[model samples]
Target: MTSKNEITVTGGRLYYEVRGDGPLLLAMGSPMGADAFAPLADALADRFTVVTHDPRGISRSALDDPREDSTPRLRAEDVVAILDDLGAETADVFGSSGGAMTTLALAARHPGRIRTVVAHEPPTLNLLPDAVDRHAEVDEIVKTFETDGLEAAWRMFLSTSGYQEDEAGPPPSDSPEQDLEDGRRFFVHELRETTRYIPDLDALRDGPFRVVVGLGADSGGLLTRRTCAALADELGVPVVEFPGDHGGFIWDPEGFAKLLGDILMTENVRIPLARV
Candidate 1:
């Protein structure tokens, strides 16, 4: 059974969902929210008490001030609040895209809160050699959103991130209004803060929790694949490959859940290619 709830944070209220019945596992995404992970959470419910949430200022989560920009640190703190609310001392976390950056921050800032972290395709542009250029590109994308509009901004974003229109998949929301709200929050308030976040490599390297950087097997030439490789290299851990591209888990939740279970259950196990 799924239970829906909300908790107050410093400057906002976070909406979250809990389901299933075992050790806690958080399936998270920024701007993606709880609904995006419902399929994967359901697939893993038999073995884990999965939790999913809307990050502050996104979807169901509401911020006190709509103008306040979200940073990785703030989002990390929100995760801590969710754990505290759930009465969980620690949880296994799976964070994708911007959410991956939030998990990395959580591991660094709150050491014992995470048992293991699977960071899938974090857009840690700061870790790349061409970071400055990439950040500038992101700035341009934001500017385009503010000027040219959403569709134009998305086209530029997809092209810059190495995803073709077909490969990037469908829009996150079927409703135009919902899409506009989500896109604005991301491009304006969250994008720069997330991509520009510099992970505390020292803390992650020496922290108590295990950190696993995940790359999509079909994510060749993608910006996030490069970022994931950079993170794995820094952490001295192997990059675990998953099925499909960046949105692999969404595309094939059952197959993705199986692989995730394997990684979480065993230590240093070889990741076999999963066919969705």
Candidate 2:
């Protein structure tokens, strides 16, 4: 069974859901929100103590410090605060896209807090020499959000992310306009603060922690996959292949969950089984 609750943090109240009954697993979603992780959380709940929460300014989470600024490192600190609040000594963290970037930052900054990290396709453009143009592209995206409006900005972001129209359909628009407004506000802060998130490679390498760089089998040839490959190489580790693409947890929730569970178990995760 999954139970939803809220936790107070530096910013405001952070809504989170806890489920399953095993080793603690912290699933961090993209910068979008924790709702994006629902499917994955449900799937993993059977064998793991799954915990998913809304990041600082997104969803049910409120902003406390107007000056928080939402930088990657600070964002990481928020996650650490969550761990501290929960009284968990360590956890297994899984993050994708922006969340993946945040995971890397967290692992690098709070090495002792996490036992293992599985980051799937972190969009770390700075790591790619050829991706220098992405800075300008993202800058234009931010500008579009400010001027042309949310629809245009969303479309442009998808295009830049290589999701061509007619192929990936429209951006999941339950309320396109409203979504854009919220996204724009949050991303404006995230982009400004996130770009400065440079991982401390030396610290990551020397940190006594196990880091898993995972990529989707279907996400091959994508920039995210490439980034994962590079990160694995830098860390002197192999990039493990997950069940599906960037949104695998949503696309194939059960399969993705099983893959995640297997990986965590292999990485020395111990979940106390309930005995009859």
Candidate 1 lDDT at 109 equals 97
- The digit string of per-residue lDDT tens for model 2 on 122-162 reads 77777767666877888888898889876677777777776
- Full-model lDDT for every candidate: 0.89, 0.74
Candidate 2 wrongly placed segments (more than 4 Å): 65-68, 167-178, 268-276
lDDT of 1 by residue, 121-204 (tens): 999898899999999999999999999998888889888999976654335676778778878898999999899899999999
The number of the candidate with the highest TM-score is 1
Per-model TM against the reference: 0.96, 0.89
**Every candidate's CA RMSD:** 2.2, 5.5
| RMSD versus native structure for model 1 | 2.2
